[model samples]
Target: MPRRHDPERRQRIIDAAIRVVARAGIAGLSHRSVAAEADVPLGSTTYHFTTLDDLMVAALRQANEGFARVVAAHPALSDPESDLPGELARVLGAWLGGDRTGVELEYELYLAALRRPALRPVAAEWAEGVGALLAARTDPVTARALVAVLDGICLQVLLTDTPYDEAYAREVLTRLLPAPGTRDGRGPGSLPPPTAG
Candidate 1:
């Protein structure tokens, strides 16, 4: 028998790995399982990914794109005149508003980094990517803080299975943002200073 040309085999395997993780979580992800899910030869998975960690790294990288795509779709996030906190809260709402299966899948692969050393760098990429986008609106410190707060908010919502409150999220995010005219004298995305009541 001759070999068949399947250009999308690698991507198919990655997609299958994501589905497997979504259904059975990281514990259920294996080359055999991915092969069956992808419907490619078992050898194909092994050939593409030498180890489970390799496959996981690919899946995590792909999963991390879910939120990034949402963020990218909102150009206002990069604008200085936009309401940073409100925009971020709105973005979070949009991400969380859709079917949660993708969100769960992304977080599962992200959390797997705790036990899988190979996945740590890939997991960090998600934070780094978001931070870079936020850097345009604020200082590096604030950008990093925003990432942390966003992560915490997402975790809380997912863990508690509570409805996402955009208003609460915007208020919480507002506290982390620098007051107007604070960042390098470039007043972009600055919320008014809080009143002392």
Candidate 2:
């Protein structure tokens, strides 16, 4: 019989690479290590990923995809009246409290982008996704600024053991938003309709 392609094997290798980065940092990633982690022959890794850079790119893309999904599913992203900052704070707190590994992996990918230009697009994609969600409630400038602020807060939380403070986050985000009744020349108790992406 002619040989058949094993599609899952490629994904398994990518998953193993991510796990390796999460546990040991990107420096520990290697075909041998990923193959061993995935319980596949070392050759399988090379067959799927021609080089370490290729593997890392795949891993970074995968991580970004997961992050986008989490953000997309956030209630605040969908609810116009939801407390955006509070939702962000809650998510950040949960991530810090129990999902440290994922946070670490994400940071690792960001660091990797410093040396690999190819990996930079992955970061841009993440930022764009976040910006689109924020744009729904604010102007483009405010949306961009919010993205930057959110990133700074997340980085600070990751670097230090500071517990996420929802009130503080809300205050910061509120500063970025237009006063409750003034945006787009609307009257009191009004909010701008969400911008369509």
- Each candidate structure's TM-score, on Cα atoms with residue i matched to residue i, is 0.87, 0.82
Tens-digit per-residue lDDT, 108-144, candidate 1? 8898889889999998888888898898788889999
Query: Candidate 2 lDDT, tens digit per residue, 53-161?
Result: 8998999989987677666656665577666655665555555566789988987887788899888887788788778877886777888988898778777777886
**Which residue runs does candidate 1 get wrong by more than 4 Å?**
1-3, 180-197
Best candidate according to TM-score? 1
Assess each prediction's global lDDT (C-alpha) against the native.
0.85, 0.75
- lDDT for 30 (candidate 2): 92
Clashes of each: 1, 0
Lowest summed-lDDT stretch of 10 residues in model 1?
188-197
